[model samples]
Target: MTGKMLRGMVITLVLAGGLAACANDPSITDTIDTRSAPDGMKTVGVCYNGNNTTRAAVSEIALKACPKGTTKLKLWDKDHMANACPLTKVNRVVFLCLH
Candidate 1:
């Protein structure tokens, strides 16, 4: 392929990759924000990139709900009472499913 064509392809690929990354994160946040589990329910976030979950669920829950991808599901953990959920009270469980 010509040099110009190659450069164009590379630029397009880079732009696509960046957009994809952006897309993934926000979706998870949105999901978490708008989620509400049943009364006295706890949820665990399933990591999209790895097997283990994150410990930031506590901080995340504290923040105001926005979207699914905003908080990231894997970062959360199951609990009898929403212990670490940023909110003062967690009456139910809502999974922060992250991509």
Candidate 2:
């Protein structure tokens, strides 16, 4: 392969890697549900790495978001396809934050 072509390929790979790293950041993955929340309460969602995992990781994220207090309402998979707690594979925790 030509030197210039090889360099271009390396640059493309590096840029792709950077983008992938940014996309996987947990902070960016978390979401908040304010649209459906009742007055004085907000819903916080956090993602975990493993499926069917404990609440510890997500709980920490919720607590950080709430600061005052929070109540875990439900847990679901990454897609929010099912209502399951202690999530199964790519856990996304939903918590009710009191405001």
Candidate 3:
């Protein structure tokens, strides 16, 4: 292949990879755990890429996880750890669904 062709291929591949890394708006990239806490409160485990995620987006994830019209969310826990969020570095936020 010519040098020009090779460079074009490389650029295309790079662009494709970059696009793949971008999360669709409001996309949830972490595990969604809706388990009952000891007090019977509902909880969800969610994470986001701190570099690109927004508070509203994260809130939307939690809202969608809970049963609509039945519960409100309360932040229960938060931390940063490796492998917590997919497609990006770690940042986790847990919310409790309160009745």
On lDDT, the leading prediction is 3
TM-score, predicted candidate 3 vs. hidden true structure: 0.64
Lowest-lDDT window of 10 residues in candidate 1? 45-54
Model 1 has how many clashing residue pairs?
22
For model 3, residues 1-99, the per-residue Cα lDDT tens digits are 999999999999999888766643334344344334557666676667777768888888788887666457788777666435654546777787677
Best by TM-score: 3
Tens-digit lDDT track of model 2 for 35-92: 3555655566765545333556556666677645454444322445342322323445
C-alpha positional error of residue 86 in candidate 1 after TM-score superposition, expressed in Å: 24
Model 1: per-residue lDDT, tens digit, 1-99? Answer: 999999999999999988655433311212254346556434443222111223354335423353444444433333323333322222333363343
- Could you estimate the TM-score for every candidate? 0.38, 0.47, 0.64
Q: Distance (Å) between predicted and true CA of 86, model 3? A: 3.5
Evaluation by lDDT, superior candidate among 1 and 3: 3
**Runs with alpha carbons beyond 4 Å of true place in candidate 2:** 27-39, 48-64, 67-90
